[model samples]
Target chain A: MPDGGDPTALGFRPALETVIPLARAGPIMLRVGVNGYGTIGKRVADAVRAQPDMEVAGVAKTRPNFEAERAVAKDFPLYAAVEERADQFGEAGIDLAGMVEELVETADVMVDATPSGIGAENKSLYEEHDTPALYQGGEDEDLVDTSFNARANYADAAGADHVRVVSCNTTGLSRLVAPLEEEYGIEKVRATLVRRGGDPAQSGRGPINDILPNPRTLPSHHGPDVKTIFPDLAIDTLGLKVPATLMHTHSINVTLDSDATADAVRDLLRDESRLFVIPERLDIDGAGALKEFALDAGRPRGDLWENCIWGESITVEDDDLYLFQAIHQESDVVPENVDAIRAVTGSADAAESVATTDDALDMGF
Target chain B: MPDGGDPTALGFRPALETVIPLARAGPIMLRVGVNGYGTIGKRVADAVRAQPDMEVAGVAKTRPNFEAERAVAKDFPLYAAVEERADQFGEAGIDLAGMVEELVETADVMVDATPSGIGAENKSLYEEHDTPALYQGGEDEDLVDTSFNARANYADAAGADHVRVVSCNTTGLSRLVAPLEEEYGIEKVRATLVRRGGDPAQSGRGPINDILPNPRTLPSHHGPDVKTIFPDLAIDTLGLKVPATLMHTHSINVTLDSDATADAVRDLLRDESRLFVIPERLDIDGAGALKEFALDAGRPRGDLWENCIWGESITVEDDDLYLFQAIHQESDVVPENVDAIRAVTGSADAAESVATTDDALDMGF
Candidate 1:
């Protein structure tokens, strides 16, 4: 009946305090594998490479295409996500380092960035290899032990066998909500997601010429996925797919527990590393300028790693807080994946982990 | 106290019911003088032209520019908004029909599309001519007797000497709020405006590389502007300017009087002539595609004249409703302007005015 200091009882490996320092002393790098190198996966692999303590073990792809060539050009060890497609790389004159299973076996953690639903299929394989894994928002909630947003619940993932990095919209909602939930206490939250029709490379998907209510179901699954993070939080989310490939924009309204000024809310969010309170002067007015700013600022693949919030847009009327922020669909999760690696491996606590990830990735704008 | 039959005592002209029908028989049209040939002004002028019962007496411009030429090409008798700038038209090889004052004197009603403060400045000119005036949202609240949103309060403007068509944002907000207020009742409202940095042609303005909290003030002026229409409503708004000229996107959350479903809200909005509940299938996702859809759909100036609400984005949880919709900053108000003409002149009731304006402009897309 001992409740304290039992690593086995707590269900985690030797405490991160013991394990992380040892890995640091030996100069041994954590091998991180990225599966499904598409919009999210490619960015995750690059972000994994950015961390000083971790190295990308390899990247896995279902087919030997442009992304496969990209994986080779980046010098990332390429693995076949589908065993049957192993020869596609060799025939395409690309050499393969191994299959995804081998990558899972060799790496310390595998980030499942495969297309939605495919991650669920790959989960058994990661489990067979006893590899702690990270899944993107596209996957089901059951596939992960917890839905992760570094700022919201970084520590929750520590020693967890599987973690799902919430979708871009949820990650965005979580970042904004966490501050309110912690600093002001959220009474209820409602957000409408103006989602991009598809990733920039997703040409085949869309209501290309119209605005459609994606999922046609009330309170799109995004709300429930967010619930996975804050189980008691009352949230309702509605999603719309627009013919946009750049980023998703979220209109958030949070009813706080107490009345707070826009300035107070701004100050609170400003203090968070992941929430970039866009200065009034920068005038990053919309997703277009945000992307351009990212590209011009020389962000890798024009990535906006932090939420681009309109500082002037952060306003409070009575007890309600309203603001708009853009979420870069392709790269916002990259930093989270890096932080998740530390979380799952007992490498760092929340503050130390987030700070390291933020500093290494140059997150706060 | 003989208020029963006296139109003046009732604060409206019986001319709409009595004189209008007689004037129609005599081939006389309602002369609408558009003061200001900018983004809103030009569109209003054209919309006035489109009305079967009205004609553009003239369109006033500050300077002889390309817009003047466009006005000339459209054969709208162009007037000089600034008397001193009249010769500029001749110098630019564009002919001027008259000065703004003459247009005001000749027209039965003036639709003032002048820049924000300029509308106030021209209010005296309109008063001097004893002409009933309809001002755009840009003017100060006190400059007009009431703020008009056809769907929300069309009847309020009937026989009113002066009315200010609410801003693009306000007009859009009123359309959505009106339905909820009527069917379910709105307890409170919170909205974030993702506004266009400038109209497509106003290249001079913007946070060209950043998103800015436009107005940087809490509960942006838009809320009070909406209050100008619904004086008793409890609403709060936050505003952001994005670097896009196509349209303004609104993220709205309404705490209703009673609980409702997304389907109920969608059905309610669908019944509105001014609100275009973008279907779940067309996949019209963002300003870019919405604009493209408008252009491809062969709308003049690629204007999406109705509020583009994402159908699937309509969701209600508890007594709250959330949705994202785009307001074509340039033209959503165009149909509203036409409806306001009918409203102010007592030409139509709320439903009739809205329907006539919608049919005349091919609104409700």
Candidate 2:
């Protein structure tokens, strides 16, 4: 009934009525190939398998490791890189029909989770096979047809062959920035990124005992990197390194041309369905509690894969506005990756894909 | 002369006369007892020695190690805290007299760079000895008489015995927030902290490859922490952790009550002596280049160690404003620490110390 109307209402337009039913469309079949089965690739594969409409057709790993062996046990068709000996997978008792290139050719879509520079190369492999591929945030902004966020720019990737998910930092920044840009004409944007040195697995990170300026540069290009998504928008960025690692936090300042109260801005943000403005109440403890809540909610990832804005921090002064929000890079992009898969396949209506994705995310905090 | 008057032609009043030549402030002797020789403590010691008006009278390490031995070679008195064994400092070949309590009593000022929760315990020691001490940003804001910033509130530390330097994140936030707050009354503030899992040496920190929401709580009290410095401030903060070692960055949004052009705001910041707004020119590269420049400048600790604001990023539409700046925590606090030493010693005029400290900083893109 939240649809607010009967499909057979007398004044109903046929086109609108026809699309309404798409909301209940059954899941579509998807053949997904995952390359570079590291942290992100593995997660992507697991998430795809969870979606009723999608399935992991195959997966490719650079080397035969315990992780690769586990993927094989999961029955994911495994493939090794050509650079490695073809018999490597066979030696590990993991059968491979062919190389990673063959894996790319077999899937309807590919998800590239290689290291920064490697994603672009993997992207080319997908293109050579005439298969649409999704690239993670590690690649430079210029490599993709579009950097996709289901809520922000899902439609932009509707018919594109290549889509890049903005860097985790960019994804968070863009999600927060896009809404502001749409509601208020953004004149310029400023942000500072507190980044982690390395993951627990990457123990080689440094100056751990000391806090240092990661980039002595003023206005790190991260601001401009955001423009790859919203061209013609003006923005700038600054960055620093700290000794904590759950997410990248940003301190943003936005200058507006029109006078608006902080409350008005907060209201605008709250109105967005995809965005979650953390309530002033609840008083959830720390990032740890928030993560637990997300997990309890059965969110694809523990925290909001989408942008989570803090309600209390939202403020407005004359035309200037300030507020804080967090973005879960890993999960935020998952939904987008799902949508991108649907977009490439053209197997389901856009409206249906979005509705299904949103409904699935309803179980999330 | 830049003094704009004859050496004494200005018919100096008693207020204008000097008790001691600015150059002859007798190297305000400072015995720095660093209990935890970690990232922040090491930087503080290095910064203290770099100051012409300050010296490292003594230093201590929590445990014996190559780092501790290095401190000893630097002529720093080292100590061990193995229960009663720590008391051996008095008998050591070096001048390691007294317990941490005695060390606090001997030092004109003590910099508590211990981990969080430790600073609060050491407060009583400083109070008992009537010795002024500086605590790191990790301590609760209320613990110190004031949070000192050489450029923003150097004068507040004037006659106070205890001052707290805000955390690296807060320091960065304060640097950007102060300017905006002064120019326009802030109605509210929201920030996203893109925090790193760990520093280079801190490999044990984090969710590793996972990105998580920190302090799932709304209004991470970071804003309140900031208010410890500006009690009446209307601000709130949200935090996130990402898998990167670079620096923590913030994306800030501000809503203002009045209409102002972005140019007007940028001009105001550009004029501030302590702020180095990156000029539109110089095509300064990324964070790496900036870091290199800082080191090349012969900066005692390398990099600006200050808030480096970007020029072109300043933009305003109607009443909104936006800009970005980078804050080097370890070094940013160095200047403030140096100034605090002078204030506690009363060896130089407060105004002189403020001016010299401000001038001594290499504020630029």
Candidate 3:
């Protein structure tokens, strides 16, 4: 009887006006469908679910592997990425809602998590469904309307139909550069990326026992990618693939337009939501221990969502700012994906979305 | 008569001039005593013995510990660093040639390898013995006439009574900066030292789980130490203590007065005798793997004597050069100590001494 007073049970009592909760009636929960279900894809789905006003519509997978089983266990409705391979899910005992196309059409937004080149191919399908999609860093810039980094260019992505979250290294660099460019005005930037040989799950690739210049060229492609965000920002990046699999460490040196102290730069970066200036007390010095700390903290997949900057490593002399920072290769882009979803869908403004995402994920760990 | 024409051995006649072969002894082998039989001291003794123009006068130790045992195993005459402890060695059954004072008086030059502050205290002992000494990086620059990095300013140390081989970090930075400054004029330099919490053998130090800004100040002593070599070079340095103990990695950024390509910078570094540009095919990526490769390749203590610069990590854009390089804290300074001995004694000029030391040590590994 407490569920809602019935007028008939109250005899001649005047019919009471039924009131519906505004949260339940105001707007439909935004459904976000994720495709690919790989390293970036799996993280994106979890981040999407973390938003207060959003719900994961479903996740599409190519095969009914462990990840698919994981998706089911996490209670995410699974869909088939390839129609021809749909029966594989049933064989694996993972029930699918439908094909990837149905999920794409059903959701208000889709995050394309396919391998690098494959994102370009899936763009047409996103267009067909008229669903706004976010792409991962592996895809080229031209594949999307604009490359996205929550802290760097959130406003630029507002209402855009498709956005690409930059790579882990790019996200890491963008986060550092954004604060410098805004507060100090960057003159030019130079960064050397000590990249991981491969992600933890990637077993077959490597230089294994050797050191090689990846492109064997001056200024790797990363510089151009940074340019995509700050088109006028002068930057050059050198790449090295080390045997480590946990994270990518960056040696960054930036020349600001004007002089700034190392302390000032540290203070500026600390204010940004995505940059985690590692304090001297934590002793999270190298990538090995940093990853171990993450795992010990019970982070899902041991993800460190913020750029880990060595606090004491920030040194400024004259107009130069020098520092060492590590980027979690797998999960830095995860939070960016959440922010980009809001940016592309106009669900929230930059500040609100960034704050909400940062709060929900508990960044700066 | 292969044995001097002895009829009991063979019937061969010996020429009267055959006895003149002793004249080929050339220059008297410079007797170099290593005072402080710890990490750098022990290595310096071995390096001196390896030189065709030099020999280890003797090694001095403060304790009859494992290192003393190892010194004896290597057939090095051991002298007690502390006179009070001299009897302890005799009690421990370590046969000593004499006291540390006797070793200093016997040698033409002495290399002080004591702890940082103790090196400064040992200055009077060497001076009393009239033996010019080469100090390790631990001592203050004022403790010596000049700080020496063999590649940076070998000529400056020639005939100087006191020459301090710069610290492992400084030596590492100087090795990189010297080539860049010579090939292309350097307007300014910035470096970040990702320092080891302690050497591999230091069991008592560290946050173990924390990264600390060692001095918590801008422009660590490293920048000033660099100024000792390049007085006019403008530089700033930041220091961070990480958990790793194997080696210290440096993130170096230099602003050149002119332009240069990645290949050009790499070629210039490659030509230097002490700088080892890790080739692309070897896959020597991180400090961990680099150490492993060295150990697997049978390097003594798995020491990488040369600056381990990743070939592909060198990038030049406009007037800025950036790269990542690792300095094996233990042995990089070993070769420098040998060269410093030659410089202080005026035994050889820069090129000949560097070449001799490099060749003897089988450098560029």
lDDT of 3 by residue, A243-348 (tens): 4577777777788898788778888888887888888888665776777888898878788999988887787767778788888888999988988877776667
How much of the real interface does each model capture, measured as fnat? Answer: 0.20, 0.11, 0.14
What are the per-residue Cα lDDT tens digits for candidate 3 across B1-365? Answer: 01123322432112112312332345567778888988888888888899998888789889899999989999898988887877898888888888888888788778999989898899998777667788889899988878898888998876566789999988988888888888899998877676777787898876353344455546789999998988999998767665567777776778899989989988999998878888879876577778888888888788888888888778776777877788888889999999887777666778888999989988766
Chain A TM-score of each candidate structure, as shown? 0.93, 0.83, 0.91
Every model's DockQ? 0.19, 0.13, 0.11
lDDT of 1: 0.80
Model 2, runs deviating above 4 Å: A1-28, A81-84, A99-106, A117-119, A122-129, A140-144, A177-188, A199-222, A240-246, A252-304, A308-321, A358-363, B1-365
What is the TM-score of each candidate's chain B when compared with the real chain B?
Answer: 0.93, 0.80, 0.91
Q: Between candidates 2 and 3, which one is better according to DockQ?
A: 2
What TM-score does prediction 3 earn? 0.80
Residue A155 in model 2: lDDT: 69
Candidate 1, residues A1-365: lDDT per residue as tens digits?
00115445755644345557877687557888999998889988888888888899999999988988988998999999888878888999999998888898888888999988999999888877767889999888887788898888888897887899998888888888887898889898877676776777778876443334455555778888788888999987766565567778776778899879988888998998888888989866577777888888888888998887888778676777777778888888888888898888887788887888888887755
